[model samples]
Target: MRAHHRSRLLAATAAVCALSVALAGCSGTTKKDSKDDAKEKAQNAKADPDAPLKKGLKIAFLPKQINNPYFTVVDKAGIKGIKEFGGKGKEVGPSDPKASSQVSYINTLTQQRQNAILLAANDPNAVCGPLKQAMKQDVKVVSFDSDAGKDCRHVFVNQAGSDRLARQMVQDLSRQIDDKGEIAILSATQNATNQNTWIKIMKDELKKPRYKDVKLVKTAYGDDDDQKSFQETQGLLKAYPKLKGIISPTTVGGAAAARYVSGSKYKGKVVLGGLGTPNQMRKFVKDGTVKEFLLWDAQHLGYLAAYAGAALASGQITGKQGETFKAGKLGKYKVGKDGEVVLGPPTVFTKKNIDKYDF
Candidate 1:
């Protein structure tokens, strides 16, 4: 609710509106594909408004991986939301962050007859079959953070607009490096949907004339493990000695990169920026190892996902464009094309404002 947060949200909305217009004018197979997608959505839009959940609805959350701090925080917030709505909530997932690791859990939740399954998919396509089966069983599915395929979920709670977040990353890094230097990206898994999308948009942003002197030297995947991420940061420094900045869009990768840079020889020489929580990046910001980083409220992201799942299960709104629902505390949200719901814009964290936020 800060002024910075409001500006980011406005920027994100403007970016999404611009993208919608651009896509509308495209011709050829892209247009045909859009039409086909719309037809499919129309066919799947029917939901029984009379069939609300009975008492004590059971909801299960399956994050990409368990034991990761970021997912832990977000999942706890989801659980809180579910309980607030008088539903039972549970968290389940794999220890490792792999695309196929969540299949068994999805099957189990489906068999258990959960009212809804809130997921953060590791890969876009790997879990679609199991999720589709869950759908067949009348279990509503909503994805958050990282989404599965569109057909596999009822809704996706996007943390921020893809183009806006990507542009913010580039802008922050460029400011730190004086708009001219070699930079590298430390991403999560190679197949992560959100990470790949942001990376692609970042590549596009770098093509602008203002960034002509900026060179993307390399992109390395850390697999979302703290140790692996730390090692990857080390490898990037060694591989690109002239690297002036690093952008890591995963919380685990961002924190790991900050830790590595804060302790290593590149402490004050190389700048680090990306998506990280206030708790994880506070020390680095205070120490001057990381001057700026960005993240939305993960708690609110989870809370919104839970409410979206509840709305889908209760048939309050079908996953159609312009369908609106009220999420507790956050007010109303409208579903856009592809059943995507933007949580809000990201917040820029710095030493001056970092202490005001807890999550």
Candidate 2:
């Protein structure tokens, strides 16, 4: 029965226009319709950077998966930031990170008249229909971590520059394998925007003259599940005994891969690394299963997302390039092209510095 429900859900997500979502069915709301409505709504009131933030604004964060430790730190930090601005916020999400699992929550939040919905979209387009209806009702949409597509959201809070972070991870991994070996990527969900963006950039980067001998053996998805990632790591090594490294950019995937390699016969033979929180990767680093890894502070990422959402809901900004808003303690940040706000550079964690930080 659970499998049947999931199958139907997947079918609906694949054809969101043919089925009803949070605001009902999507019969006439095509991609062109959403874009057209956005253009029609473009005559928005001017943003006021100095406007005082309003009190008691209703905002909620929906991460890809609530069970993931990375998002736990992120969403809790978001709640902390919202309170600082006199707004009320909470974190809510599905235990499973399916593409369509977040749709029901989006509908419920819109019905509750939430002032804003801060989302880490599972799939860029899967959540667009409900998000558009939410916007039509005056609810602001701010995407963080992953995106809800440009037309569907008012702003995207990026942890770091996408291309820069992806390229940096590739370089970080390449050095560990001596820049020439069979390597595979164990990533999050296949449709995840952030993961896809990083994977594409990494693939493009590997084509350069600098990494000609580094053959990418395969790209596998663990769906951000710990056990699945562990198994995927095991499979990669077994399938390619000559594999020298595995790059997992998702926190869960990276940590799971490390755990797998640490206990298996592949320990020192196969290097495991990628975007990992300092605390989670510390043991792996100390045990010599991982040499180094990269990550931005998840707390800072969530904290910034909350302030950005509040700023939009308060009329302080309209997700336009060049507009700036003040994030409490973190200070001012300017929106870049397509409403992208980058947190900052990611830190590379090694055995020497992994113990110095937590979360």
* Top TM-score hit: 2
Q: How well does model 1 score by local distance difference test?
A: 0.89
List the candidate 2 regions with Cα displacement exceeding 4 Å. 1-43
Candidate 1, 60-160: lDDT as tens digits: 99998989888888999989998988999999999998989999999999999999999999987788888887887778889999888788888899999
Per-residue lDDT value at 109 in model 2: 95
Report lDDT per candidate: 0.89, 0.89
Query: Model 2 Cα RMSD, Å?
Result: 9.8
Give the top-scoring candidate (lDDT): 2
Error of 1 at 201 (Å): 0.3
Error of 2 at 166 (Å): 0.5
lDDT of 2 by residue, 300-342 (tens): 9999999998898898998888999999999999999988999
Error of model 2, residue 183, in angstroms: 0.4
Q: Model 2, residue 263: displacement in angstroms? A: 0.4
